[model samples]
Target: MSTPASTSANQQQTHTPVGLIAFAWTLVGVPLAYGLYNTVKAASALFGG
Candidate 1:
């Protein structure tokens, strides 16, 4: 049988540093933003907007 304390200890949370988290988001966000920009550009050209 597992005690509550032992169960909680086993599930200890790991943390990522803020700088690394920001870098990871930037990696994902840059490509996403570029893709969205090109998509809107192409769509505007097609619609003559």
Candidate 2:
């Protein structure tokens, strides 16, 4: 009825488990990226100014 990938995708949605991990990763990634960006900005400000 469904392809393997589709089946897995359906299962993933039905259980809604992996999405939590994905959401957490997104939350963590954004903050981590922002922190790194700000750190670089601070260093540049200190050195270049």
TM-score of each: 0.75, 0.54
Residue 43 local lDDT, model 1: 95
Backbone clash total, candidate 1: 0
Q: How close is candidate 1 to the true structure, as a TM-score?
A: 0.75
In lDDT terms, which candidate is top? Answer: 1
lDDT (CA) for every model shown? 0.92, 0.87
Off by over 4 Å in 2: 1-16
Candidate 2 residue lDDT tens string, 1-49: 7557656546643456898989999999999999999999999999999
Error of 2 at 22 (Å): 1.0
CA lDDT, candidate 1, residue 1: 75
lDDT of 1 at 19: 100
Give the alpha carbon lDDT tens digit for every residue of 1-49 in model 1.
Answer: 7567666657878999999999999999999999999999999999986
- True-vs-predicted CA distance for residue 46, candidate 2, Å: 1.1
Compute the lDDT for candidate 2: 0.87
Candidate 1: lDDT of 14? Answer: 90
